[model samples]
Target: MSSQQQEKYEESELYRIRHSAAHIMAQAVMEMFEPGEAQIAIGPPIEDGFYYDFDLPRPLTPEDLVAIEKRMRQIIAGQHKFEKKAVSAEEAKAMFADQPYKIELIEGLETGGVDEYGEPLDEKPEISFYSHDAFTDLCRGPHVEHTGKINPSAIKLLHIAGAYWRGDEKRPMLQRIYGTAWKNKDELEAHLGRLEEAKKRDHRRLGKELDLFSVSPDVGSGLILWHPKGALVRHLAEEFCKDEHLANGYDFVYSPHIGRGQLWEKSGHLKWYQENMYSPLDIEGNEYYLKPMNCPFHIEIFKSRVRSYRDLPMRFAEWGTVYRYERSGVLHGLMRVRGFTQDDAHLFCREDQMPEEIDRVLDFCLHLLRGFGMNEFKAYLSTRDPQKSAGDTQRWDDATEALRAALDRVGLDYEVDEGGAAFYGPKIDLKMIDALGREWQLSTIQFDFNLPERFELIYIGEDGERRQPYMIHRALLGSMERFMGVLIEHYGGAFPLWLAPVQAIVIPIADRHIPYAEEVAARMEAAGLRVEVDARGDRMNAKIRDAQNQKIPFMLVVGDHEVENNVVAPRLRSEERLDALRVEDLIGRMQKDIEDRM
Candidate 1:
């Protein structure tokens, strides 16, 4: 969300409704336990809905959720007026002394250092409590006038997940109940429908259904084992992008998986990024750590030799795999993995060529994503975080303005995320909006003046002086694993014709038609199509159904009539049957679609 939209959302009536709904839900849940059994933690209103954390007496279930939801509606119907009260530390402590979690939060509030969520506070806050009926919580008030203000029909209790207190894994585990609330039942239904569709399109479920990928526990969490079909789809996507890169003046480079500790220290990774990096490996009496980025190695290559103004603009690209340490709790299918390959590239250009290079890269990013039929996306310009950033004020400002200028020149609408940049520089992040309107961060064009200076990279200028070239780090597809995850969900496993693992499947009507099917498949394959021939003795309808389930683009049905006419009846996965056509004509039409990336 942009700053203006976020401000509007936070101040909107629906925001208050969700906030009050969370407190009401908390009241309903607190009633589930005895006087001092259930401990209440913090509850916050998030995008789309609200969630409340609780240290419950027992593990919750679906039945428990249903019961809690029922009680919530009752609480809402009670029409109790919400109230707030400011109290002293002693008074607050005495009110909920039995609740250990609330007491801890109260202590944080009393200290005037950290907020309720344990984040550092810029100034001391006036501690307050919000109460509706018998339950009250230590909170800053911005709730509805009364419980009756919330629509009962618009409210729902989603599900439960385990969350550590204050996001600290070592802290006590709490049950987080997620729920959504809208202005009306119609909106609620619409949201639920989208959620149902999302469930069906979930990458993990579809990945297994389509035999695309898997996360084997034996292979460790967050590690993807790409099956043949998934690997082929990735290969086709990468090959297409690689060809484009080569055509756009990018040269591929190879880098090792680990680097010396001193190299990382010099690059400032040891100081700013060591938390995400794995422990160093002891090799040849030197410390070598798994590379979490390919920038340093690419810089080393730049420093390998001297270059004049003629060689001022150099672009190095790589399908480099890097490793980072991710907690087991956050290890998602392919979306959030510990190890993945980045479609990484770095550009070293002199000051005079920087603006043109940025524009070209931005145009190329759009072209590449549009090839995958992803045209609905928003760009984000992340400025430097003062506390975390490494460069001087003037350098950071100039780099940020350059990226902003590029976005404006392209006429792409973008959001500026203040203090969200990487430690070393500013960046423009391209987030692709999927079919369901969820944004997936895919491409990034980062501007770094820090790395070139850190590595002491100098190129001879026209004035015969050693000058630091502007460096840009770019990744268009971010990572193969995550991009595949997004692509699988975006298309719902029915990829476009160009990127489909099996573009066409030839289904034989009977055992006698097997020879014709093989012949047709051979002809299509010879024309640069990924075709499969199903010669099983199964029924024709069964084969067609299987082909559709596999999400193939074309299902070529051949029998006596097609064999005699020397043609094929192409049935689309959409169930639309095209008229029978000669093998050459069918191949021509398919080739056109593939070329168009339809």
Candidate 2:
């Protein structure tokens, strides 16, 4: 959003309504508990809704949420006018003496430090509190003028969960109540409907139901075990991507999984990224670490050979796997995994070639994503943070402009995230909107001034002098594991014909038809289709149901009639049945679907 748009939203009635709803929920919680029993913490309005944390005497239950919401409705009905008052630091501390969490916030405000929630206050400002009815708490005011302005039916208590104070494991866990407040009942209903749809498409549930992948206790958390079916889909995706990269002038390369500690030091990973890295192992007399990235090794490859300006644009691609330590609590299915393969590539180009190269790569990223059935895309340009970023000011400015120009040249809409760039360089991150309208960051094209300079990467120019080369890091699919997970959910496990592990299943009506089913499967397999034969001793309908459950694209049913006429009845996953067709016609149709990527 632009600054003007953001200002309009922050000043809108809906913003005030949500903010006040948070306070109302907090008030209801206090009334439910005995005085001093519920230590109120920070309650803030977030995107789309609000949440409040509390150090309560006990864990809240579903019944407790109902009661609290009921009390909030009553308070809203009372039409209490919100009142704000300024207070001195000493006075604020004394007023909230009974509330330990409030007292801590007050002290932090006074000292210009972080509060219990770890929200920083660079400088102490005037302390204030907002009150409505008999409830009062520490807060910054921009609330509704009166509770009557809020629609009671528009607010709902969503759910309850445990959250550690300040998001630190060492801190005490607090109960967090999440709620959504809308302007009216209709909007709330629409939001709830979307949530229901999202639940049905959740990747974790579909991953298990479709038997694509699993996280086993024996293999350790965040380490995914891709079953055979899942592996096949993944392999197809990789094959498609590799073919595209090769066609686009990328030279495929391979590197070891572990590297010497000095490699990371030269790459600056040790100083800036050690926290996410695992401890190094002592091999012989040297230290080796699991490679956390593929950039350093790619750089080593470039340095291994001296080249003139003719080799200025060197694009090296690899499906490199890396490991990083992710907290167990945050270990989601495939989204936040410890081990994964990145579709990583690096391009070494001259200064004059930077803009065109970036534009080409951006186009390639969009084309590749579209080929994977993801058509919606938007780019985010993250520029350097002055205080934290490395590299010279001129280089940073040039790189930022190059990224912006690439987006403009491609006629792509993008939002600029000022000061959000990594320490190394500016980047353009492409996000794909899934079927549920949820955005996933899938591709990133970054300029790396730090790495080239750190490694002293140079290329001989036409003038015979060695000049520094610009390095562009691009990851089109981001990671194979996460992209597969996204694909599974996006299609609800019903992949397109080309990507489906089992493109077709031949189901025999009776035991005597098994030979015919196998023959059909063999014919299909010979035509380059991944076909399976269901020879189990089950009824025809049961076999068809099992094939449907597996989400196979086509089910070719064969029996005495099919065997005699060289024809089979085809059933789609959508339960649409086609007229009996000759084997040659079926193959042609299936081939067309695969060619079209349907």
Candidate 3:
């Protein structure tokens, strides 16, 4: 979610309605168990809806959710006023003596440093309770005035999922009830429709159906194994982006997978990003670590020799694969993988050329994404945090302004996220909005002064004076794995003609037509199309249906009529058909589609 949208949601009336609904849900779930039999963990309103955690006597079933939801409606109809009460930690504990979870939360509040979620707080807060419908919960709430404020008809219980207490694995696993609450049934239906579409376009599901990629426990989690077709699509994407980078004055470079521990220490990754790094390897009695990023390696190349001012704006680009440890719980298909290749680049320019370099990089980022048919973007400018930043404050401020000015020059919609930058520098993050109106972070251009100082990078000017060079870091597509995942969902597995893994599939009408289908496929292959012949002996309609499911851009049907005319009848994935054409004419038409990137 965008920052503006988040702020709006937090203050909206719907947020309050959902908040109260969560409490109602908790009350209903607790009522399911006998007195003191069930334990309530936490219930909170989240984006789009709310969820509540519980340690029930037995695992919850769909039937139980239905019963709880039905009872919640009755409670809401009772119109119970939500009343709040403040109490001392001792009194709060005494009141919920049997509720061990609430007692633990009260102790945290009493300790004076953290909230109920175990996140740090600036100061101790007063313990409060909100009661309604004959049940009370420890909370700091902005709930609706009465239970009637919530439209029970607009609420739904989504599903049950297991969650660890306070996100700690060692803690007891609680059953979390996910649900959504809207103001009315119309809005609820629309949200549910979007969710249904999202499920259909889910990359993980599409990955299996399309035979694109897979993740196996035997191969380890968060590691993607790209099948032949998936690899071809990825290669075409990288090939196109690489050519663009070269045309834009970027020099491609390669770096090793592991580096000495001192390299990461100097880059501040060891100091700041150590948790994401794996345990070091001992090579020749020296500690070495997997490269979590390509920045340090690129910087080493910059310092390989003394550069001149004439070489001020040197752009180094790489399709470097890096690995970072991601927990098993968060390991998602392609989207949240541990091993991935980044479209990483670094720019070394003099101070005088920094602003222009920033502008060029932003323009280039858009150009690359647009090449993939992604046009909508939301830009976020993240400024440095005072407590965690390196380099001079003035330099940081100047770099931040440069980023802001670039965004302004481009007239792109953006938001300011204060004190959200990396410890090294201020950066501009570009998130591409997909077809479903979901934003995916794909491109970024960051200004870094810390790396140069840490690495002591310098260049000689015309005046024969050695001066430090300004460094700009960027990742156009972020990572190939995540980018492909977003692309798959954005297009819903029906890729554009140019990027389609199987551009065209040939379906023969009968066994006798198989020979001609192979001949037609060979002719199309000679014309530079990714073509394949389907001679599985299935009926013509089944072949067409299967081809459509595979998202093949074009399906060529060959039979006596087509072969006698020395042409192959072409059918598009959209079920649009065109007159049979000669092989040369077909090639021309398909070439036109590829040229337009349709």
Q: After superposition, how far is residue 400 of candidate 1 from its true place, in Å?
A: 1.0
Q: Which pairs in model 2 have colliding backbones?
A: none
After TM-score superposition, the amount by which residue 372's alpha carbon in candidate 1 deviates from its true location, in angstroms, is: 1.0
Per-candidate TM-score against the hidden true structure: 0.87, 0.87, 0.86
Per-residue lDDT value at 202 in model 3:
87
Give per-residue CA lDDT, model 1, range 325-423, as digits (tens). 897877777888999999999999987788788889999998988888777778899998889877578768877887889899989999999999978
Instruction: In model 2, state the lDDT of residue 44.
Output: 82
In angstroms, the error of model 1 at 354 is 1.7
Q: Which 10 successive residues of model 2 have the least lDDT summed?
A: 112-121
> What digit string (tens of lDDT, one per residue) describes model 2 on residues 172-272?
89999999999999999998888888877777877887888899999899999998889999999999989999999999999999999999987889998
Error of 2 at 535 (Å): 2.5
CA deviation > 4 Å runs, candidate 1? 1-17, 36-41, 55-63, 77-131, 136-154, 164-174, 182-190, 279-287, 433-440
Better candidate number, 2 or 3, judged by lDDT? 3
Arranged by lDDT, best first? 3, 1, 2
How do the residues 1-598 of candidate 3 rate in per-residue lDDT, one tens digit apiece?
Answer: 7765677776788999999999999999988889899999888898889999999889999999999899999999999999999999999999999999999998888984678789778889989999997899999987899999989899999999999999999999999999999999899999999988888898888989999999888988999999988889899899999999999999999999999999999888898889999999999999999999999999999989989999879999999999999887887778789999999999999988988999899999888888888877788999989999988898898899999999999889999999999888899998865434567788888988788898998999889999988889999899999899988887899999999999999999999999988988898899889999999978999999999999999999988999899898999999999899887898889989998888
lDDT of 2 at 472: 91
Candidate 3, 418: how far from true, in Å?
1.0
